[model samples]
Target chain A: MSSFAPVLHSEWLKIRSVRSQCLALAAVLVSTTAFSVLMCATLSAEDTSEAGFDPVRASFFGLNFGQIAAICFGSLAVAGEYRNGAVLVSLTAVPRRGLFYTAKLTVVGLLALAVGLLTSATCFVLGQAALGDLGVGIGEPGALRSVVGCGVYLALITLFAAGLAAVLRSAPAVMGFLIPFLLMLSFVLGDVSEGGGWVDFLPDRAGQQILLQNPDGPLNPWTGTGVLVLWVAAALWVGGRRLMRRDA
Target chain B: MTSIDVTQLTKEYGGRRAVDGLTFTVRPGKVTGFLGPNGAGKSTTMRLVLGLDRPTSGTATIGGRPYAEIDEPLRHVGALLDAQAAVGSRTGRDHLRILAATARIPARRVDDVLEQAGIASAADRRIKTYSLGMRQRLGIAAALLGDPEVVMLDEPSNGLDPEGIIWIRRHVRQLAAEGRAVLVSSHLMSETASFADHLVVLGKGRLLADTGMREFIEEWTTPRVRLRTTDDVRLSAVLAEKGFHPVADDDGRWTVEGARVEDIGPLTAEAGIPILELAGEEPSLEHAYLALTAGEAEYTAPRPTAAVQEV
Candidate 1:
């Protein structure tokens, strides 16, 4: 394979150069932070008194809205190449199909990681400030994990979208498939399964376990993250295989 | 010598084969013009050569190595597959810069190629706002940025203006002269005729003719001798007696097919018929191409006159 570092740099340049892709990354930060602070401030005292009200998880309620931007960022990173037939030019430069796809995913993953980490950390700090005395600290049980888990969740979601985009070869199509699947289908899967062990294997449900405190889910937070990573790995493997087999 | 060689290459898309068993070599130090009508597999063959499309069978290599094996492929082969193969939202300079990074080409080379392609003024402008001609130039700039040994351009002159067309013709010739292998594909016969030293004509996913430009034209077309003398009627009689079939046009110029200048010149001088102009009319590349692929073309335009002449 060609030198990985230069390809990584080139892919990074590709992501930074496009205005819409960068805008999507910015949306991930803006939407996540703004919503998290709002959710923390607006939480009713009566609602907090109810059972199973995890303040740390509730602080990240804005992630429900923020994940969309992360998905878009990932999808556009790969699908944009198919937009004006730019994939041909990209593959021509780096003819090894597997290496090119890997480089592209690495760039998207890293950018998402950076944006995800900053956004998650900011949201945690700002959301705690809004919660006043009721706010949780990094020293609190599962607080640090939830804070760090937010960034991991966002990055994994981004990689998932990137992989799906490669397979589908359309940003709109990948978004169409993922948005409903993440926003509504995960709940539907839980409701239908009645908290069955099968629901723990679903990517979003398994990943969200990391962000929850005193989770009743079968898998631990780290293991839940591992499940999401497996889904991402499977997705990327399929996408890479298709990319290598198909004509540019 | 950085030549491109393909042996029995084939690509099948479903039941249809886009490029079937194509075998040819594009040598360095000369511009080889790839000619075929639309759907004749010119683009498909190019994609196969560049390793964009996986061949169903056989191999295509550059300098005895598959394109996938080459590190920094842009440094070995510079190809302009499509002008629109770029992010329109980015400035033209950014597109070249990203590609330059891939090849580890210096940042200054981006500006140099922009100047070389005559798009220096529009380098910082977003590609979406640029014209089709400008996009083509930007693609050219990106291709030459790495200063690759082999250049493959598929229909580079399509969106170019007349001046741009001439410029590309001259540019490819210069690249070839500098000892780089240049393979250019075009449907424009006149454009290919001007700069190409060699020709590789394709028809219906198969090779039609692969030879030198002059030789291909000569082999496919009948060279005719055009004669204009003081007395056309006498000259026709004299040429008929000399075992030459000369056809007279309405303008009184007689043309003899399958004849050379040497045979006609001496006969005209011996007759002392006041030969005003006796010149050999070299067959055009267009006419020769049409003759060579007369029936092999996958799709031909409907002729208004509707007369099919046998070659």
Candidate 2:
């Protein structure tokens, strides 16, 4: 166990010191946080008379980018060995495939959660402040839940993307397959799809459940989250099985 | 105790057999040069021993356990398959750190190995900025992180300069001196002559010869004696009288294969043949290897000029 700790620490160093994960996470936070502020500031004063704007949902719109970064990090973890033919070196060091896989997943998961939570909180606060007359405050009935939920949404979506990338084990293949799938769900699945009843089952739609400040969204917050978690678990199960059974 | 035991180890890629029935013990305190051509399965065999690749047929073990079964492999056996295999963006120290961490070695081991491989001063620099020799040193540092008993290096001197080549040779020799089983592979036979105590010569995916240095040298070398005498006619007559075959050259010299040096010198003097240049020629290890792997010499090192006479 202690031996594995250095491996984990090294993985952390690679993640933080390297360009990919840091840059991608930064992009996600900056884009999403900026978008939330811009959207809230543009909201007209008349909008407040009708209903409050969802500050949490507005804060998390950049999760779409954050999710991509998760996939990149995860895919690189497993597939980097293949690209360089260094898989031999890795397996030689830590022969247990399951342990190796677990360490990678743990590192990616922890980092994604930390960055997602930070980004979500920052986006929520900035967006709420910018809303002025039209914005929903944390004191509002569902505002805090929505704000926190946005963070969970970011983490879950990122993990799910990562698991998918791991299973595929090819960067181009995962990117090519997942990006369109994400785009389809966020854009195409949102329209002409029976008020997103089916779309709500996809990871992107289900993850969005936590961002509803009105507390009147189609799926209840927990159930929608469950749907997202189920998708992530299922993806991980498939990915983990593939990795376990195949030769590294 | 067996330094390394490989039993009927075999590896198949798709339909091709990479290592076919490769079974040999690598004893400690001696270098066993694994000689083979490109794509001749040297790396594949090493990979199987390290448990990086599963053998299709047999087992390869060290200390009575497969490599993958070892608790701390880097400490048990160190290998350098490729120096540049680790990511290039990380610094040299960082790359060693990750490997050292996995092996459960002390953090100081990273610096220790860096120093051992003589690259500690450049530890803080990024790997991408490293020269080829620097990367090779980093790779060796990673391998030595565990301070294992067995060290396997694949072409550690592949792209190195003459000085770097000598450096690797000295290090490898030192590793063996410490009673480690060092298996170094190369396609060149000349590299093995001095480096290997035991030689395993391979050609076109099959074992051509496996023997000790002295025995191989003796067996491969054909015996010949070169004699230069002023009285070529008298020597030829003495040779004909004794029924010995004498092949005279343009230099008024006779070359004999059966006569001993003691016999040749005295016989020439007794026969009234004043000798000028008299020397015995024996075959070298390179000659033996070329003769054994006749058609399989993929790339023989060009003979250097001012060649030493085989006397």
Q: In terms of lDDT, which candidate is strongest?
A: 1
- Candidate 1, residues B235-262, lDDT tens digits: the string is 8888899899999879878889989899
Q: Write the per-residue lDDT of candidate 2 for residues A1-248, one digit (tens) a residue.
A: 64567567656765665666567667657766776677767766565445564555665666666566656655665555555555666776777777776777788777767777787788777877786655566788777787677767766766776677667766677778777787665677577665546766777777777777554556788888998899889888888787667656
Error of 2 at B129 (Å): 2.8
Candidate 2 similarity to native, TM-score: 0.88
Worst 10 residues of 2 chain A by lDDT: A47-56
lDDT of each: 0.90, 0.74
How large a fraction of the reference contact set does each model reproduce? Answer: 0.87, 0.51
Off by over 4 Å in 1: A188-197, B295-311
RMSD to the true structure for each prediction, in A, is 3.4, 6.3
Q: For model 1 chain A, where is the 10-residue window of minimal lDDT?
A: A187-196
* Candidate 2 segments whose C-alpha is farther than 4 A from its true place: A45-53, A214-219, B234-272, B295-311
DockQ, per-model, please?
0.82, 0.53
For model 2, state the Cα shift of residue B49 in Å: 1.0
